[model samples]
Target: MVIATMFDHRVADGYSANMFVSSWADITRSQPPSFLPSFRRSVLNARRPTIYTPSTANMFISLSKLPLIQVDQKNEPNLDQDSLRSRIYYIKGDQLKKLQLLASENGCQRSKLESFTSFLWKITAKYMEDSGYLDHVCNIAVAVDGRRRLSEGEGVEKEDLMAAHFGNVLSIPFGRIHSKDLKDMPLTSVAKEVNKLLKTAANKDHFLDLIDWVEDQRPKPLMSRPFAGTEKAVSIMVSSGQRFSIMDKMDFGWGKLVFGSCYAPAARRDYYVMTMSSPVKTDDWIVYMHLPKKHLNYMETHASHLFKPLTTDYLKLYD
Candidate 1:
C-alpha cells in the first residue's frame, strides 16, 4: 500500500487533481530532442539484437525501513506545516536469503527479485503492528510497463528500445494485500499469495484486457494508477529496469550525473516504490519509496542495520 502524509487538505487536493492534469499535459506535449542521441546510439550498438542487458556498472543496494505499528493520534509525527517525512527500508544478504527461503516454501522461486520484495511486505506488516496501524488494509500496486507488450514487434530490440521511444507507458495492477492478512501470516505464506496474484496479472493479454476494461468504464475516465480512490485500499506501484542508461544521455553539456533517483511526493498515504538503476553503481538499483512515518520510524529502530543511508552524495540529488 502507498502511504503519503499531506500537511493540509489543500496540498492533497492540488495533487489529486490539478498537478496530475498538468503533469499529464506536459508529458503529452513533446519528446525532448535531448533524448534522441541516447536512443539512436543504444539502438545502433545492438549486437545480440534480441536481448538487452541492463548495465551492471555501479550497483549499490539500499533498504527502506518503516515502523511496524500505526502511530496513534498522540504518537503521530508532526505535520503542522505542509511538509511530512517518511521512509522505505532495504534488505540484503542474510535477510534476503531468509526471504528467499520463505518464498521457496511458499511455492515461488527464490530469486533475488522475489525474496527482496517478500521481505519488504513482511517488514511492512511488522511496522504496522509496532506502530498500531494494523487495522487498516494495504494494497501493493505493481505498475507494469506496457510498451513491450503493446509494441508491434517480436524481439528484444522492441522491448529495450521502446522505453526510449515511448515516454511513459505503464499499467497499474492492484496487488491488494490486506493489512490484516499481512500481519497474521508468515513471510513465506505472504510471499506465496503475492506471487500468485502477481503471476495472474503479469501477462500481455492481461494488460490489453485492462486497457479495454478501463476504456469501457468511461464518464469518469481514470488512469490506472493507485491512490486514485479507485479501490479505497493501501496500494503501491513498483517499476523495474531503472532506465539509467538514458541518464548519461540526458546531459545538457553538464558533467555526467553521479547518481539519480525518482522522487515521489507525499500525496497519497498509500505506499509507492520505484525501482530504478542505481546511478552510483550499475549492478544495483535505487528504490525510491514514500510510505507512512510510523513505519519509517519502526524500520529505523529495528532494521537499522540493514540499509545504507540515502545520503545526497550517493543519490546525487544535489550538485
Candidate 2:
C-alpha cells in the first residue's frame, strides 16, 4: 500500500505533516501513537522576561528589511521557478557506508546525513565553478526538529510530552561558504562544517531562545536567513526523514506500506533534498530532490554511481 499527502508549506512544515501521518497510522492500527500531538499553546510559550540569544536572531530575517538585500553581483539572475524540477533517487546502503567512512576519515566522526550533505554541497560548488560563478556563496541548510531539545533534562515524561507536541517546532541552521572555499575544501572538512552548523541549533537553549525570538518578532513576518541574502547565492535545504519509519510502521492492516516519499512542487523556487529510509532495503536511502534542472543534470552526469534513479526494479515489486 502507498499513501501520500499534499500540504501547504506556509501552514506547516514536513515534521508536522509527518506527525499527522504517523498518528493517523497509529489510530488505524488501534495502537497508541509513539509521538502524540499536543496542541497547548503554552507548551512553547515565550520564557519569562523573554530572554533570547543573538544567534537565534541570526537564523531568520525580518521581512521588513528584505527589500534592501543585494542580488548576486555576478550577473546571475534569480532562478526561475518554472525551471525547478524534482527527481527521486535511491542510494545503496553500501554507498552511504562508504561516504560515512570517507567523511569520518582522519579522526573526524560524521553522520551519514552530514556526509551526504557535504558531498552535495561540494557538487553544487563544482557546478558553480564550472558555470563561472565561483564568487557566489553556497548556502546549505538543515531543518532541525526542536521538540526533544526543548524537553531536554526535564524527565522522560516531559520528553514524551514534547515528542507528542504538534505544530512547527523547527529551526533551520545554515552554513555559507564562498564557492571557491567550498571547492577547495576536502570532503571531511566540508562535513565538519556541516556538523558545526547543525550543532548551533540542535540544542535545548537554541529552541528556547528561538521561542523568545519569535515572541519579540511577533506581527513582523520572517523567513530563513539564508533565503533572504545574496542574489548570487545557491541555497539548499536538507531534511532528514529517517525517523519517520513510514514504510515499516505505517501499515494499517493493509499489508506493508511500500515506496513512500515526499513530492515538492515543481514550481517552487527553493532547492530541497530529503532522505528517507528504503522500504525494502534496510541500509539504503530514498532521496527526494527538488532542484534546478541544470543541477540535477550535472549530478546525474557526474555522480551516476552514487545516485541511481528509483525504479520498480529496485523495489522488486514485479514477479
Candidate with the greatest lDDT versus the true structure: 2
- How many pairs of residues collide in each model? 53, 3
Worst 10 residues of 2 by lDDT: 72-81
Q: Point out the worst 10-residue segment of candidate 1 by lDDT.
A: 53-62
Segments of candidate 1 deviating more than 4 angstroms: 1-83, 86-102, 105-108, 152-168, 223-233, 246-250, 266-270, 312-319
lDDT of 1 by residue, 1-319 (tens): 1212333331222112223332333344543342321123233222232331121111111112112444456654332223335443333346545556756863446665555566667677666555565455565555555555754455776664654442233455445566667877776676666666566556665555554443333334243333543332445555553433433333323445454444555555446565555555545445566765565566667767555456765555654
Q: On residues 1-319, what C-alpha lDDT tens digit does candidate 2 reach at each position? A: 4567888866666777888887777888898875667777788899889988788889998989877665544675445446788899999999998999988977767999999999999999998888676578999999999988998899998887777767788999999999988987999999999999999998999999999999999989888988885456889999999988677777666767866889886567788999999997899999999988888988999999899999999988796
CA shift of 239, model 1, Å = 2.9
TM-score, per-candidate, Cα-based: 0.61, 0.93
Candidate 2: count the clashes: 3
Positional deviation of residue 65's Cα in model 1 after best superposition, in angstroms: 35
